[model samples]
Target: MSEPEAKRIKMADGTKAPVIGTHNGHFHADEALAVYLLRLLPQYANSSLIRTRDAEVLKTCDIVCDVGGVHDHDAKRYDHHQREFNAVFPGSATKLSSAGLVWMHYGKDIIASVTGLATSDANNDLLYNKLYADFIEAFDANDNGIPIYDPAALRSAGIEKRFSDKGFSMAGVVNRFNYAATEPRNAAKASVSADAPAAPKQKTQEEEDTRFQKASHFVGEQFVAELLDKAGSWLPAREVVKQAFADRAQYDAQGRIIVIPWKPEGVPWMEHLYNLEEENGAKGAVLYALFAESGEPDSKWRIRAVSLEPGSFENRKGLPEAWRGVRDEELSKVSGIPGAIFVHASGFIGGNASFDGALQMAKQSVDM
Candidate 1:
């Protein structure tokens, strides 16, 4: 016989909402995040969530996730517990969980929606890949119990043990909602409940449901906040950085250093520079970035070293060694540049009291 078709729930407002079902009792980050991503899409924005393990209830859900016995995307069933099931994204070695599965299918559309970018926009792919590498992959690896490295290999390499403690991760945070003893051990001992038929358990299924609801909300809030930041703040800064890079020749004759004008706040510009570099095949062309201090007086400008890669501290070219740790008049005398403020001891950044002096410092450092 053919399987029974799933049903949709009708809201009080007379609008129909798809029912999303997951297992009850205990929840995890994977399902929490998966549900959040699903709800972000227009099709599921007003969907109702049903938390239960009953086969009848699950069968009535328009879509089942994390708790379903099968993993069939076309059927709208997403679960990874089956013995023969092992699915990984293209070009990835780690197996996917419910969260990853959801992402693998709808990630591009979700990112475009969240970032307010058209699905055809070039940066959508960039942001999607970056987020997966930095955030979603961890959820997939954690859910599948995949270690960063093989424990036996590490042991053979003289690493005694692996640190499995990850108490701050999203998964770790969701696990906190699991049941714990309501009464203190000392209090329970004092009560002595052996004769009283286990003192009718105070915590109920209602409470578990409440906690699951709260956790799902929390995960959804975090997901929205992160994507908003990437879309609103991080992505827009790319154009500003690109324009500054294109105008590098106006700032310096060699076009080796890009100067960014003052802004009220700092922006993430380095990644954009790297992306531009990769596009132009001009890797290592620009060695330094000079920009005005965000909130500082007009006299102040900051010069920063350009790193070989995003987030890496190692710079393509550091400031002159002689200028390291020097300040004020001494720095001016050593570098032979007027308005020299200070150069950091580590040589990653330096300051000047004037824009010309900052540009001069950058040029001189490049020559050195």
Candidate 2:
């Protein structure tokens, strides 16, 4: 028997074609942009952008979209920006979702400085696309830098009905709300709370020292914990390096104790992809860091400092000469200590709000 032919539907106008809205290539285009940026900067370990979320792309795309300025076509450069230094992001001070945050504390000129990629002839659309493409190099979800559109967070803030009423899809307007609305006041208090003590126009040097000491100790702990959590099977070593920093008495004279765990053999940790294997036969993956750092997988990396093995050296090239990864490079640039930290007033971690806490709490002054 012959099979029935397919039934085709046509537009009301009888144009004999499908009626479909234009697929907003915004999200897909954003993803493409992100992937492009990540692919270019393979030199920086932090450039390992990994998130594929639509909302993230939208948010990042939004930021890059707004960037533009004067350019000198003759020089073939956008402008003289401290591109090298900004490329070396000294840890961010603003919350990630606060797209306006960059403009609030940082200037648009700064974006041009590091990007050196976005040009004067380029408009917002082109600049945004270029920035998005550059961003995908390392989109760590856990990093506050990664734009996390939590629908639940929106729901908590009465955003579900708001979004529904506005006729915008969750994907379109997800990153446009204030998640932590109560933080600005809290940060103010931390800076100028004088209810119980003698008031001063500015925080005394002693207060400054106290803040750094506590925050750095907290940072070191968090780093080690994060590493162990990422390491799959390795545990932090019970032994810690016993030494005190000469600057202040933040830690003990014997030293701030740091523990190193046993690192496994032949594991894959190239470009934020950590594949661990036990000496015995244990096999499985562990945590996925929002933003984990890694060197070139193809290039042999010297273990400059392991979470458990401090001051340890390894020869990635094989014998005699030993070279190690610089674990503290980024953090040291931001805070004096290679791995120092700043905690938020609220105890929670891994959110942009908490990152602002770092900015407010860090004893160091904001240079930019």
Candidate 3:
């Protein structure tokens, strides 16, 4: 929509729709995602958006973001560009961007709106933190220009990237919407001015605003997709992990092995496992987990090592070294267990054709 046309949009009841204000020139992923996130609320679902840097105009706006040089949560100002600003998400070192700022204040409400959970629910708080850490923080880190790793540390460790993946991130995708003059608007006129310098072409205010809308929707789609997956798939898996953890003694008398009776793809178990372990005062107690490889009856069962920490690559304990990379009848002969499939070369995981075989592998590995 044109800038003039969007100056004010009235609600259905003839009341003035609340206005969201931001900078006008070019937009970035932080502000784009910020605006989209705000619109997810009931009050702002039909709110009008005004992209401008004018302080007076922003003063009249119900909410201002990424342009107003203020970070007052009570006043609904969420800009992060002020020289003195150093606000980060609670308990996190990464600095806030407009996206993270918006999320910090209104994330629970947004989660409720999308997932129909009570705003005060414990699960809502879980998702609020989970979504930020897994998804929203990247936008904050990118907009603030924070590298994932300290460059000096990476260099000191002699870790060099084998190839470049420039312009391949979600931030890069959003940046593609920024206005660029692919070719001069009037090439012939510029050619005629051989001796004089030609002024660079620029997108009109309306064109720039439209691109901003496109960019917002682009990031917003991804944000919603991630939120839904967390709420729908990831949240439910917490219960399964909790149950399996509680039933650990059924598989191992010493409670060293937990069993997931059923197998579903992409089940997130480690974080919940660690939390449960700490809560029950059994931290670092679970060494192995056994579960069916698939829902199919004849499918193999897997015996896997538990990680030392949630999301860590290192494990607390690995399968026997003798079983590593051994497969089929040879694996069965080496372990003296029937229906053996193979063990991972790293010994983090192994598979067998039946639940009893997989269970025996875990029991033997624990002794080793």
Model 2 bad stretches (over 4 Å): 1-146, 150-201, 229-368
lDDT (0 to 1) per candidate: 0.81, 0.25, 0.88
Cα shift from native, residue 103, model 2 (Å) = 26
Model 2 CA lDDT for position 12 = 54
**Top candidate (lDDT):** 3
Regions of model 3 farther than 4 Å from truth:
1-7, 180-200, 263-266, 309-314
- What tens-digit string does per-residue lDDT give for candidate 3 at 151-172? 9999999999987765778888
Rate residue 346 of model 3 by lDDT: 91
lDDT of 2 by residue, 1-368 (tens): 00011222334566332111111211222222222222223222122121222333323321221112212224211211222312212243322211222222232232333344243523322333322222321222222234346667887988644234322422122222212122355455554555554243554434433332233233323323432332222211101111111211231122121111123332222211111213213222211111112233322112111122212233111111111121234333443333323222221111112222222222222121
The Cα error of candidate 1 at residue 176, in Å, is 0.6
**50 Cα displacement, candidate 2 (Å):** 35
For residue 91, what is the lDDT in candidate 1? 68
Which residue pairs clash within candidate 1?
A: none
- TM-score per candidate: 0.83, 0.18, 0.89
Evaluated at residue 26, the lDDT of candidate 1 is 67
